[model samples]
Target: MCLDVVSRLIGLHKLFLFNFYPYVQRFLQPHQREVTRLMQFVAQASHELVPPDVLEPVLRALVNNFVTERNSSDAMAMGLNAIRELCSRAPLVMNQDLLQDLVQYKNYREKSVMMAARALLHLYRVNLPTLLHKRDRGRPTEASIELKVKQYGETDAKDYVPGAEALVNDKGKKKTKEPAEPTEDNSDSDSWVDISDNEGDFEIDTDSEDDDDDDVSLTVLNNIIVTDKHISQEVSCVQVLLGKY
Candidate 1:
């Protein structure tokens, strides 16, 4: 093949692998280069770390063909599985910068993929006493919907609902909606998590004689409203990104 053609193919392959390529890239380009690259990685990681052969069919399903829910879920599951497998095989002290980027993906899209986030969090055992902040990352902190208002970050990076940190209440309340609070044990810090905190104030008390389970579920989403003002600077590092979307 000509050098220019090979270079263009390599660039297209990277774009497709990175999920940045649009609809046309797959059909417009061929799989020849990606297949070759996959073979190289399979051989390299096989001897060194990964179960190279165990994942061949998964790659074939993902990159070798087309997109559908089945393919997409397979891709996500494969990516998540690979992340965990490699994390376990690798030494401790996974790179902080790398972890931050990967954890943010399933959040903004409402994929609720905190499973992978938590897997990585526990694998790396990161206990950032404060938030992993980045400045001016290009994501919207506010949403028009009430269900997702609590999703914002204080740092320049996008705020996130950390792995299983949102919606699971540690404390019980008599009110239909549990009171809003940051999930982090940042008692040392004077900060209060305001994500959806204020919007649910009108919720019917769960303990009230007139209230029922259905009412409780209704008011619960109110906690995720636009007017929430629970932001405080004195929060743990990990919880900082947990509240905002």
Candidate 2:
């Protein structure tokens, strides 16, 4: 009935209720069920409790107790739930240090504590964007490009494949290609080519031969017979050049 009366007074005479905020702040200590109940009432009507200045102190006190004191599991859970509610309803009223301290409970061994802490963390994260009111920067205005290059160092030169990393700079060093294996045809030195000098044309060495070899000998023996008339003089000149008798 007393709690009922207080709730009624808070709803009806909210202006007067604001005046008693300091008294509530001073009296509400850790592990106090009555004080926790009153806080819950205020939290339930948080939206109507305008000018959040008073509520911030009250919630901060409860959070401080929840984080630092050895309150009952029920009380701790209540505090966590109330904080989640406060964050959703009035995020600006939350204490940053208290939220940071409460986050530690997410890693607590107790399943209920961990669960409650995680829920609160989720609530906080969900509302963070709203609280921060970040601008809708469709994308990063400043262009940033990240480049990663990996260099492998070989301790032994023998392990390096020839020309594999030729373009790669290695402390001002250059690598050359390995010599190709010799083939059988190119390995032979005394290969010969047929020579024909008196056929009205010269023959070039098609096989491996030294550049100085020019063995060409032709002798015209008798009167040269011409078949084509237009090129007859030209043919005679060629025959005379071949030492025609």
Candidate 3:
């Protein structure tokens, strides 16, 4: 396919052409087997025709080959992809209206940068679903756990305090009465309980981070809490009221 000609056709026209290419890879859905095959011919025939309107026959021909859900989706994907491809060559910028249209049509809005970003996001949705799952994920520990209090719009003012205390994972443990004294037999295992069952219950996945795999681990995505009030706003709480005689 000539890049120049493909670049000129925009909107619906460009979209139709993209579908006619059958597909760039084996990603061509199975139901679109016939439409995929038919589009190849349409694309070839389209190249020979002088009139741009002649592409309709190819569209009709391509549409005829579809009977399943995959074929239907293939047609939509092709046209949207075509328009999106052509939009890259366009000089003018696209807007929210175009983005809205692409979203409504479930097509790529190549004209708008936002639309392009959204399309890329959709591609991620289809390609990477594991990103939604929460596990033993880890983000960079660089984000200061130190408490910093600041009002809005204040850029220069910053006061750092101590970080949070060590986390205790035992949330459900109950308090028991302290024994008068420790005995020899009970001293062996008095401090702990059998946690074999809970071991598998609280499973944290350190893997399955498709997007963050290269930069950070998923295990780091956690909430940090300040354990001591003194560490936070230690100066703010200062009271200097003295009684006068």
Point to the candidate with the largest lDDT: 2
TM-score, model 1 to reference: 0.24
Please tell me which predicted candidate would have the highest TM-score against the true structure. 2
Question: What TM-score does each of the candidates earn?
Answer: 0.24, 0.43, 0.21
- Candidate 3 shows a clash count of 11
In the range 77-149, model 3's lDDT, one tens digit per residue, is 5544433332232211223343334445433232343354356335323322223122211223433222232
Q: What are the Cα lDDT values of the candidates?
A: 0.37, 0.53, 0.36
Report the CA-based lDDT of candidate 1 relative to the real structure.
Answer: 0.37
lDDT of 2 by residue, 1-245 (tens): 56456755665554446655555566556546576666656554454335557678777766767644477676676677767765565565665566666777877767777788888776755544232212211111111111111112212223222332222334135355568977888767436656677776775666666544453221211111111222344434553345541
Residue 193 local lDDT, model 2: 58
Candidate 1 lDDT tens digits, 1-245: 34234334434342123221222233321234453343323222321122333333433333334222333443454445445544443322234564565555444332434465555444433322112333312222222122121111222333433333333232223336856876567764656555555776756655766563332343444464422423222222344555532
Give the distance in Å from residue 235's predicted Cα in candidate 2 to where it truly belongs. Answer: 99
lDDT for predicted candidate 3 compared with the true structure: 0.36
